[model samples]
Target: MGFGAILDININHISTRLAYWLARNFDEKFDKLNVGKHQIKITSDTVYEVFGIPKGPKKVEIIADKRKVKKQEKI
Candidate 1:
């Protein structure tokens, strides 16, 4: 919960039935649920509303490896 936000909410147990259905129903290419004839829209707003996770930009942390990187050689 609140993945990209500073104030994160505690995680609770997920619904096994619903999760299973979603896993099987979700279409990656369409970004929606293609269950039979129904096409359920899955947007950023919907995601935030459903999961409480931030639908905004995320902060990325990169750790540089020192040992593997060599210093520039003089020309």
Candidate 2:
């Protein structure tokens, strides 16, 4: 794929997942939940009305990477 195509895919993936997470957890921001150079984060709230989670002991955390991927040049 082209550079623009890769970027578009990345943006779409993040936006889609973020929207779903927000809708389910009702949290505007996400919290980091793992050890790695990549700063992956997620919602801290457990109660998700959309998902029908009345009360949860733990919140959902989805790992994400927003770094731009280098496109391969044609030889």
Candidate 3:
């Protein structure tokens, strides 16, 4: 495999899974709820922080049904 390909695969297998599993089992700031389009979503920027890859500044989205309802009700 090429250098870039190897790097991508490693990131996918290790970093991605590690971040997800940690978020699933340990992280609690991000809350999960059922929404219309997406069934599960959380409100946390910890994923990128955990990934720790210096990409550009990007906004993270956290979606949840209860949050949506709260927003709609102006609560």
The digit string of per-residue lDDT tens for model 1 on 7-73 reads 3646443456666788999998889997799998899887787667666788645647876544444
For candidate 3, what is the lDDT?
A: 0.43
Clashing pairs in 3: none
What's model 3's lDDT at 14?
35
Candidate 1 has an lDDT of 0.69
Ordering by TM-score: 1, 3, 2
Sort all candidates by lDDT, best to worst.
Answer: 1, 3, 2
Instruction: Name the lDDT value of residue 20 in candidate 1.
Output: 73
lDDT of 1 at 24: 92
For candidate 1, what is the TM-score? 0.48
The C-alpha stretches of model 1 lying farther than 4 A from their native spots are 1-11, 49-53, 59-75
Q: Tell me how far the alpha carbon of residue 9 in candidate 3 is from the true structure, in angstroms, after superposition.
A: 3.0
Query: Per-candidate TM vs. native?
Result: 0.48, 0.19, 0.19
What overall lDDT goes with each candidate model?
0.69, 0.42, 0.43
lDDT of 2 at 51: 35
